[model samples]
Target: MNKEVKELDLIIIGAGPAGLTAAIYASRAKLNMLLIEDAIVGGQVRSSYTIENYPGFKKVEGGTLADLMQEQAQELGAEIDEFDMVERVQFSDSEKIVETSSYIYKPKAVIISTGAVPRKLPIANEEKYAGKGVHYCAVCDGAMYEGKTVGVVGGGNSALEEALFLSRFAEKVILVRRYDYFKGEKATLDEVLNHPKIEVMYNWDLVDVNGAEFMEKAKIKNTLTGEEKEIVMDAVFGYIGTEPKTKLFKDYINLNPQGYILTDENMRTNIKGVYGAGDVREKAFRQITTAVADGTISALDAEKYIVESKRVK
Candidate 1:
């Protein structure tokens, strides 16, 4: 364990939109803050192809948008460390200690914006052919399957949205859903139903993926009739749901039933000095705009806490 003590007024875990936004706010306020991210700076946004929904910009590449945010934060005096993975966080009324794989941090406050991981299929060989043929973000890998047939699994909004995105590149998109009914909005359902290249296969659960190097075929079991069948496809995408990245905080922070961190409106967690934000926190929506809002709130709260602590000292 590295013994170098890197102390700051606040530490924001994750360099995604939320974390970076927090860094911007804290740094702009002249608060001594640090932003840490073990993964890529932009989080899931970097994997996206073209993001049109984000404010200000009509259309921008995901990677480009992340770069802009990162640059802005750093220019505002936010220190971003991309090497360490925060493994544990110990909170107290006076100070908060964050332990990562490489170093330990004792910041006045911590903002946990670790984000969430995509839920994957439990099928065999799914991990083996991850990038080869198995994909999660359609916007990230849809171009790879240009004119090729692809399989999409899910019954919710994410699945349907990705299927629509995939339809632009793939000649045929097979929608394999475990339930007969779609759980997405009516507008999306109508669009999917009217799509010519999309074949909606309802009540089907993906069981296995057959591929030597990449994906070639997939085996799915029908939930209603208990029938199984194999279909050929160049690639498969899973978007069932997301598991919040809160394993480290489970024993410490308060979480909801699905393991998402529980935070109040101010982004304050059960602990006073520790705050939750972005997708990692339980909220109604998980979008870039909302994440930015969460980060802003967390940073402001951290700044206020630090000022009060100084007064108490």
Candidate 2:
């Protein structure tokens, strides 16, 4: 017997905070929606040990926050299917069909909430010390180094911005850049330059992470001079960049040079029935608050599209 194709009013392609939140709103609106996720629901947020910046909770574990979102979405009647990987998405006329290894889903609208992953430094044994010492988000891990020394890698807005964020906690934050100059917002640059706790070091690259069980030193090399030095730091934060999880959708949508999906203010993509949200969409900021906001906009906009198209379930 042939496998039956599942149908829904809206199909969400990721189950992260954005996707789960979309499911919550879509299901609450009584829309027949299905949320699919192959990995953990929280996405990159799960990697964060703790988060204090998110509103409401002064401090909460990242995994706990993710679980709450997932539970809340399910409690609201959203049919969320875990461990389902979407292979492709094909848009035909006013309908969007998503194909997976196990099932094919045809929905009136599709919301892509697939998130992004942090860019890693190509250094020896870098992966081994990710949580122990090598970290990506300054806001998430900076407090652990309060009154201690840490090194930050990158020169862009995120790097500079995080450097400033880390300055509030870490006694000393050394901004390391491979190039000779910074390439982020001027205001952020001014702040970083003026920050008493920040020291900018250009023309240097992080080449190695040296530690026994946990990280104890960060080895850097001067690109122009070929001189190397090991900094006595507690941890190294990489803000080099992030890679959006849109490889499968690149053929169907417009993307920036860095591969982030292009979407309007309301998270609507160029396609009529397809939308992009969360870290996958190109935006100035990528935070839990912004991602949740994106999900709300996408779900509501998708609802509007479905009604206007007369595809109510």
Candidate 3:
């Protein structure tokens, strides 16, 4: 039997901070919209242990913040479908079609907030010891290495945050950075430097991981000198960077060289009715606050487009 096609004024993909924020605005505007999420509603924010930079709170749990956003959108009459995978999408200036496992949606406009995925460690045997030792999320895997030593790679905000979070569980944390300077915020850098549990290594690179079934030791090399050494560790956490989650929309939308969607200041894409927001779009910064701002702009612009279309009709 063929399922009935659902119709909406706007379709928001990815229920992350950006998508959820869009849903809130769209619902407040009394627009008939649907928010679809393939995995959990919070996206990568759910993986974070704590968030201190977001406004209105000194420190809040990542999962708690996501839940609050989800509740706000739901209370405002936003229709959300969680865990429904988007099988296909057809976008144009006139209309947009989104196909999922549960329903096929035809909406006047679409807002994409698919976000990004963590960049993998570029070291030998890293994939072989993925869950066993090598991990991208410290919040998810830090508990397993309680009282044991772990190594963190990268010098950005993500690496600093993960190292701080891991310190609560791991006995020792060796932070490795290829450059002498840190790319993270000075506030975070201060905390990382002051933390006794963490040992920061500058001008060093992670070369390899060695083990039979799981990771036992990691090879490190000094960038300045031609010296290499191996350090025994229970696990390795990588927070190098992230790549956009735009594989499904790459062919249809205009993307940058790095595969991120290119959108205007108002979040409008090359296609008139389609918009891109959050980490999936090409932008300098990818913070929760910036993503929320993007979501707001995209929702307002999409609302304008939908209203104008109705007026023209």
Candidate with top TM-score is 3
Error of 2 at 16 (Å): 1.9
Residue lDDT tens for model 3, 205-234? 999999889899999999999699999998
> Which runs in model 3 stand beyond 4 Å of their true positions?
none
Which 10 consecutive positions of candidate 1 have the poorest summed lDDT?
Answer: 1-10
Q: For model 1, how does the per-residue alpha-carbon lDDT over 67-180 read when each residue is reduced to its tens digit?
A: 999999999999998867887778866668888767678998999999998997888887798999888988878999999999999888778878888999999999998888
**Residue pair clashes in candidate 3:** none
Instruction: List clash counts for every candidate, in order.
Output: 0, 0, 0
Report how far residue 217 has shifted in candidate 3, in Å.
0.8
Ranking by lDDT: 3, 1, 2
**TM-score pick, better of 1 and 2:** 1
Predict model 2's lDDT versus the native. Answer: 0.86
Give the runs in model 2 whose Cα sits over 4 Å from its true position: 123-203, 208-218, 223-226, 230-237, 311-313
Greater lDDT among 2 and 3 belongs to 3
What is the Cα-based TM-score of model 1? 0.90
Q: State each model's CA lDDT, in order.
A: 0.89, 0.86, 0.93
Residues 1-313, candidate 2: write the lDDT tens digits. Answer: 4556987789998888899889999989999999998886778777555566689998887789998898899899998888878887787656677988888888989999989888987888788997989988776688899998899999786788778778888899999999988878787799899999999998999988887898989899999999999988888999787899998888788899999999999898888979999999999988899999999999999999888777443
Residue 294, candidate 1: alpha-carbon lDDT: 96
